[model samples]
Target chain A: MALLEVKGLSINFGGLHAVDDFSIKIEKGELYGLIGPNGAGKTTFFNLITGVYKPTSGTILLDGKDITGKNTIQINKAGIARTFQNIRLFKELSVLDNVKAGLHNRYKYSTAEGIFRLPRFFKTEKAMDEEALRLLKVFDLDDEASVKASNLPYGKQRKLEIARALATKPKLLLLDEPAAGMNPHETAELMETIRFVRDNFDMTILLIEHDMSLVSVVCEKLSVLNFGQLLCEGETSTVLSNPEVITAYLGE
Target chain B: MKTKSKLIKPYTKKSFITYALLIAVFTIVQLILNFGKMSFMMQSLLVPLCVYSILAVSLNLTVGILGELSLGQAGFMCIGAYSGALFSSLMKEAIPEAMVRFPIAILLGGLCAALFGVLIGIPVLRLRGDYLAIVTLAFGEIIKNICASLYLGKDAEGFHLSIKSAADMNMAPDGKMIINGALGLNGTPKDSNFTVAFIILLITVIIAYNFVYSRTGRAVMSIRDNRIAAESVGLNITKYKLITFGLTAFLAGVAGVIYSHNFSTLQASKFDYNMSILILVFVVLGGIGSIRGSVIAAVVLTLIPELLRETIGNYRMLFYAVILIAMMLVTSNSKLKGRITAYTNKLKGLIKKEKKGEIK
Candidate 1:
């Protein structure tokens, strides 16, 4: 069984179909890439899977559990954590705290225990600090753990967002244009980080990117979305070489 | 060494400093009260200083920490004041001891405000920015008007409520009027004192700090910073917002109880739009998201007008306005703020160097 399975997922905004008949099956531990031109409904598809939008039709299954139209929180709890394309981070929070906020549900203590500073609060917080720091260390962000999330440079901010997402311990991780604004050096580092995340965390990964270089190097499987439809799907090299996909990116 | 450093993180040190500031203030006031001759005006302002401080701190939880603009905090305070005063007036004979009755009244006030907080927050939380502010301002006024016209009487037939007039309650001939419309609740127990108010203020600060440092605090701040990202990370947005809204309201309610108990005559009219704005000013002038700033701002701001009252009379408020604007300019100007921060850091570095030298 696939880690994530979507069957005929469709959504519309009145007269316009934002995502139409989009369906994909991601096997466990696969580095999948979703590439398209701007506004090809790539993000809308991610929104649909992450429950930011209710699908007009079809079903979604995570590890054989149907999670179709559940809310964002429910979908996240069901193990699909995603980073935003524009890097939405808790800007005011410290780097370490941003991850700890993501660790909210995994490690538990009631609000009362938190307010009163009970023994359980201490135990859980200590564990969370350790866990959050461990994740930070992986991204080489431990040295700047106490810095505010917004204060980090552009590339590191992207890394911090990814770190925060992984803190939720999701089975499948979705990265939306993770290297959106990075130069070649940072993009290369991000590629390494993405691969490392999949290998170490046993995470089935799916990412949407316009950066073809990052996609060709990191992605094992490729799905090209054009105008809210799946234009092509296959091995990264084959899909990139497809004349149809090329026409969608650079019109004939 | 690692464990020790982990144990005392940056926030822990800041939290200790806040506590120490409070304790230092308390001790200084106690010494002035016991040995030095305190002016009658200054003595009278003590409990009120605590009240305003608590109000400012609680408001900070909503305005600064939760990142919501609420103008109905005074409405919650009004609910708290009335509920607490009513409870104390009714239970006056049953629980004669101030030790027992006052605490219950405070809790009743806080819980009552919290109930209203959750109720109002459900609808109000849906709106954001100016719409939220306008709606909450309207709610505060609505509460004040309702309380103004409220009439209650208790007798053999049990408690009666009427909005028109006290006579509309139609209680038995021997029935006593509790809330005579517009007159407000009168002759309530004067159970609040400087010590009690100070302790409650301390507790409020402690709770604010704890909530900020806790898992829940981080979640609330996350929601404040980015609602979408917070939700994507598995946080229930509505739950955290309501929790923060309700908790801040609860503390405001606690402040209300202390407020009502300090005066023999309790009036809901006092908890108006200006009162809400006054608390907000403390949060703003202190620096948003700075809990320690809220406390100090409340104290200093509250003291300024009263301290100048005898000396300047009418011009005191004019002076107060000038100071408020000056404070806002200083706090808001990035260049000035940076320079201030630099000087403070330099001072701190010097102090650290001296301590190191002493150790060597």
Candidate 2:
């Protein structure tokens, strides 16, 4: 059985159908990709899947449990985590604290315990800090952990977002345009890092990318979306070479 | 090994000295201030200053830490002050002494306020930004109007006499009851002092500081920074926002209790739109997220109008308005803009330094 299945998902914004009858299924531990030209409803699909927008009609099942129309936080707590196309780090917070914010859901100490500085509060806080540092180190961001997230270089900021998502301990991770703005070298490094995280953490990844080269190199399977419809789906090389996929890119 | 030592060494010594010095100075100044025999006016002003500090700091937890605007503090305070006054009055004859009833009254007042906080927060917290502020402001006005119509105590004829006129009317000493609409409840025990107010203020600051520094605090800050991003990581935005609202209201309620007990009267007019705005100004005038800023602003704003009282006389409010407008302009334009740029530059420099250190 597939780890995630979206069946006949459709969403509308008043008169316009933003995402129409989209469906996709992924097996456990698979690395999948979604690619489309600009204005092709790629992001709208991601938004629907991540619960930023509830579908007007359809069902989203994760590991055989329906999770449609739930709030974004609820979806996240159910073991799905995502990064934005634009990096959305807490700009005013320190790098480590941004990662720690993701660990907030796991905290067990009550407000009373925290206010009184109970030993249990301290223990949990220490563990969170250590876990945040460990994630940052994996992304090579530990050296800049104390600095404000906004001050990090663009590449490092992108990596920090991934690290924060990881801190949520998600079983399935979604990346929205993870390599939107990057030099070739940075993009190549991010590709390897993405692969490394998936293998090391044993996580399933679903990604959206406009950069065909990066998506083609990293994703074993790819789906093509156009005008809120699925254009094609297959192995990366087969789907990329499809005539409809070629026509969509060329027309745009 | 060398890198670890370099990282760990300065934090330990610097933090230890900083904490020790702060404690010593605070204690010493508190001692010196306690020795003075102040006039009634001075005491009244000082008491309000401490009370406002608690209100401003608590409101900041919601507005600054949680990144939501709220205007229902005065409503919560009204709940606290009225409830506290009622509790103390009821227990005065029952309790052996006035002193014994004081602490119980204050606690009861705070708890009552907290209950209202949770009640109002559950619904109001669902809205964000200006929506929440508007709902809260309306709630505050509604509370004040409701309190204005309540007649809690009675007269000799058994007809519910207005609390304001109860003292003037002839009544048995044991049968005297107070609390009237718009007339203000009179003859409440005046037990609130600078020491008591400051102790509560101290406890509030300590609790607020711990909350903002904890994991829950970070979650609140993140929600303030970006609600969508915070929720995407599984932080329950609504739940945390309500928590902050409830906690802030609880503190404001405590301030209300202190105010009522100190003045020996409870006036519904004191908890109105003007008071809520005044507290908001305190939080904004101080850097919103800065605890020290709120405390300092509370003290300065409180003392400034008082210092001008004799000179400006009844026009003290005009002076306050002028200063508030001037500070708002300065802080919004040059001061905060400059600070932001400076802070960004400092963060960049720190990053570079860390990179260099890592290279070594």
List residue ranges in candidate 1 displaced over 4 A. Answer: B1-8, B342-360
Give, for candidate 1 chain B, the lowest lDDT window spanning 10 residues: B1-10
TM-score (0 to 1) of chain B for each candidate? 0.95, 0.80
Best by lDDT: 1
Among residues 3 or more apart in sequence or in different chains, the pairs in candidate 2 whose N, CA or C atoms overlap within 3 Å are: none
Model 2 lDDT tens row, A144-172? 87788999999999999999999998888
What shift in Å separates residue B291 of candidate 2 from its native position after superposition? Answer: 1.2
- The residue ranges of model 2 lying beyond 4 angstroms of the native Cα positions read B1-40, B97-99, B154-175, B311-322, B335-360
Q: What is the iRMSD of the candidate numbered 1?
A: 2.0
Highest DockQ scorer: 1
What docking grade applies to model 1? medium
Candidate 2 on B168-230: residue-level lDDT in tens?
545556564567678767777787887778778878888888788777788888988888899
**Model 2: reference contacts kept, as a fraction:** 0.70
Residue A147 of model 1: what lDDT? 85
Query: Per-residue lDDT of B198-233 in model 1, one digit per residue for the tens?
Result: 999999999999998898999999999999999999
